[model samples]
Target chain A: MESDKDNASLLGGKLSVINVGLDKFATELADHDVPVVHLDWKPPAGGDPKLAALLSKMGT
Target chain B: MDIIEKANEEAIRRMLGAEPVLINVVPAREIVPNLQDKMILHAGPPIEWDRMCGPMQGAIAGITVFEGWANDLNQAFTMAASGDIAFDANHHHDAVGPMTGMTTVSQPMLVVENKTTGNRAYCAINEGLGKVMRFGGNDAEVLNRLAWIRDVLGPAMGKALRDMGGIELKPLIARGLSMGDEMHQRNVACSGLVLRAIAAAMAKTSDDGTELSEALAFISANDQFHLNIAMAMGKAIMDPVRDIDGSSIVTAMSRNGTDFGIRVSGTGDEWFTAPVEMPEGLYFAGYTEADANPDMGDSTIVETIGLGGFAMGASPAVAGFVGAGAASEAANYTHRMSEICATENPEWTIPSMDYLGVPTGIDVRLVVDSGIAPTINTGIAHREPGIGQVGAGVVRAPMACFEQAVRRLAEKLGIS
Candidate 1:
């Protein structure tokens, strides 16, 4: 998961209303260190470490 | 017009500006658990007789034999054919049933009372997995489990309720809304709350710790037991607003063994109904589309009133049964529901709607005007009877029902 600061920075580039890749989003978030609250139901095959951080943090 | 006619007429008047609502349910029983059974307890609208697949019919026969209403499978069929037994939706009686939602007076039903209007409804417990009536498989195991629930669990809970005054589920629901439970698919928080409250009261004067522990464990294990309460709470909350004069707020969403039906508050309680179909989504291992039952039970009332699928975003985990698209569809479902509603819930709000207030109240006019049918987040069962649950999916109320409702409301309200 990315830090809140990095997440804020990456939100614009990573998030897309239609068809945004979660991997790219998670990676960008990780780069910036933004904390993701949770993961979408299906992951981007093989799962992402950023997603793990988000789930543990979110307690889902 | 006489009272009955007046009641029916009143039902019509409420259909004008129906708003949707979110209702949460909690058990008044001291201990809650997942009552394990041979069949997965399916909930919601019933399937049509002609439409029933093999499993559904089998479950019906199984229920009869389980209840001792019939001596055997052949006798059960004979009784059904003779019409000696009444086949009514749990919704009609203000009750909810799990998948395949079958119930009889003999079944120990949980009567949930909405204190606001003194309106009460009943629902049978969810028979957890395997050969349960809702899944449409009937066998000795199913019958024995039914007997156990009625003979033991029901009575024990009755005593506990008597000991610790009736419970108020309203507060728990309000709190659960924030936690992650939509009070439908994700009731983990709500379940815990129910158990905690009841166990505290039961501990005061209970038998051994083993009995108490076992009961508590049961509720913790089953995620769907609270569905009955949610259905009742929805019934209770909506009952107060039912048959309001010239109001289009929908008050009740229910299904008989054959049709999916709803009552608009301003439409004067006249039921607009349509045939039910299976919802498409994920299901248990080994269960395929062929293993499911059609929509069953009265629990749809919960979703109809706004808390079930519409609030799915709250419980992201719900993606399992309803499938992945959980978050966005949660909002989408809420948005679709808003098309039919007259107002937002002043109280309940689903966080996934970005914390937007739930689409409260189903309005007939809005439904007809927009042509966007309300989307229900539901579990899909096999089209044939007796096969049990094959998967889960989303479905919609037939558009014609709302169209007719709007037209009728227009006539009653003298709208051009």
Candidate 2:
């Protein structure tokens, strides 16, 4: 339990980034050795109901 | 690692230590060394007359008329075609200019010097907005404005600047950055600050009250009057970093309408070039993207020293000028650019970024590895000569240029 707490403190929890603009900001963070998850942002329907339904069915 | 580390440190140190002062305004022939009869200075990497773009050709024709070498455009063209004129890149003479970027001997230029290093750079006074020779407007009105700047405005400014001892720009740039100016696309704050700095001296130097007030009023109303001074300042700051062996930091970036080019610190005088790209943004009435010339100018020197697009986050007001209106969008451009930079400039900080400094010292390797190019906010000239500016927008340096710089640096350092 102490080790788990120490590990959590050491890592400082996951720091995620949603880069909706240029991909480089995330890349810079990554280059600095920070773990960053890039969120692929798109409008809810992808402007197409049929395509969004297909994506949802594929469990995306 | 040692060589690159040392060079990068030296580059950054000189860039940060730079204190550009607007010391004088003088005829280009008087200050620009080696400027002789029939010689013209143009922007970007060097090129031949045959390959010169339309606006450049127009500026040349207009300058010829202004110089009394030719009576009109037709005569100028004849002389140009017959090889009676000589042209050289402005970079060769330690100068930078906006669109069409013509600096002939008789033209007056604002002289900026880095007081710390004794290095200097020159740029023509900004001929604010429409129907100007810089954008290839060759009408009598254009020539008239140029003459007024040369005969009246330039002399008054020279006297005022000399009387005031000189105006330092770095502090104004820092203050302007804090107050809605990125010092390129938006210089309204800096212009006002510069006016306040020199107004008393300007008033004192003028022969009459009317002349003084007119000159002051012209600068007051023209928001872009500070741009050429800023370009000169950028050139002054970046010059000491040039030719630093093994450093990958970009020192100069410029474009002719035909080509885009950059000079890396380690690469010395060699230029890495790619075809120019058209800018994407808001156009003036009756003009569209089709009207824009490929991005052309030495104004990118602003971005080279970490202002303009690199400092976009600090000036959300300019976002609308480049299609993005949101403050978040502005911050995103700056944040994205940080990835390709060696370090954040310690001096120039952005208010929106929680006062984090703007990114400085563009690293070629990071640019290539991330496939991200440096962004520039610029005025788009009309594709044809003599049409002047059609709009303002954002553009990116070509990736190929960065890739080439990286390849050359690798070869120079004997690395794979």
Candidate 3:
């Protein structure tokens, strides 16, 4: 779960997504001079075990 | 001068030589190169519509009624099939028309001419949205509006145009290009400029206060009323370069809600065609996707030669209708379109283009070589009978049609 501060930071104003890996996953339109509302994907509960395991393997 | 000579002369001067001309708008029957398979001499016309959208059929029905050729829809279709009425394209005769581009013999149209080069261009008058013929809603009220345009608006505009000598559309398009307008969807600044220019004429030459008031009111009311002028400007700009020997530049693009078609310079006046699809976007309050028709209209000529959907970043409102993307998609569309064009509009420069000219002259060879056909921003009509404008969206011109046209033209030029 996102804290109110983090949610506000993402929602209330612009958040320039950092790093190429995340940028590739997210919509590439954020960098333009024009503004388009951004959509994000969040895992459920503690996190999806499958996704967590996959990420851990990638990190290794 | 003969219409063909006039058209060819005008087309070359403005398009190839890069000059401006006063475009002359006329009915398709009056100017077509040939009349084969035509229904009524319509603007950018002669669309045979078994494949047409439901709304287009409605407009054709209204046109039949307007012309006193038939009392009802069945009768109109029967008469059309029996070949009693002539159908023809406006561009086929050296003119252009708007959506549902029906031009009857009686309806007067705008005639923009370039005196220096003897080139001319044309377009029919605007039909205000709800229940209007252009949006493909046909009724008694629609016929009445057409009548009013014929009896009052057309003559009044012609008189005003004559009184003002000639309105230089280039300046307005140039200015609009800078102010977030690609001379297509968002024409606020240019439209306002046209109204103001016409208003000045209305102020000077009219003793009939109400007539002048009505004209001014009408012009001020519709944001897109200047689309006619832009069409005229586009014609003036592109008509000159047609039939330039081996040149591959495109001079025209128009759709009949059933099919989208284009004409390239190398092929003279031949139209290459493909099936049209509905634009992919949002709708006005009460409309839906089914309410929309496949993309239709002469407005595509704005982009065919560049400066409408090709320059979308210049018009944000268009993005709302055609799906959303940021400035780059819009800019990239312009840049991509540049790959297919031969030149840029010296006068109509897009601000987002980093002050570069609006891409001019669509080239079929480049389109085939690069694999990116132009995109259009358009209105969709209901697919079924009686429902009008459901939504608006964006769509691409099919690449197959361009490839076919290029193959044929290449064969003709021996470049294949």
Best by TM-score: 2
Off by over 4 Å in 1: A1-60, B1-56, B208-210, B324-329, B352-354, B414-416
Best by DockQ: 2
Model 1 Cα displacement at B393 (Å)? 2.0
DockQ of each: 0.02, 0.03, 0.02
- TM-score versus the correct structure, for each prediction: 0.73, 0.88, 0.79
- lDDT comparing candidate 2 with the true structure: 0.87
| Candidate 3 or 1, higher TM-score | 3
Instruction: Please provide TM-scores computed only on chain A for all of the candidate models, following their numbering.
Output: 0.26, 0.35, 0.27
> Worst 10-residue stretch by lDDT in candidate 3 chain A?
A51-60
Candidate 2 vs candidate 3, DockQ winner: 2
Cα error, candidate 2, residue B286 (Å)? 1.0
Q: How many residue pairs clash in each candidate?
A: 89, 0, 36
Q: Please give, for residues A1-60, the per-residue lDDT of candidate 3 as tens digits.
A: 889999888778865544332344445555454344443323321143543332232221
Candidate 2 vs candidate 3: the TM-score winner is 2
**Residue pairs in candidate 2 whose N, alpha carbon or C atoms collide under 3 angstroms:** none
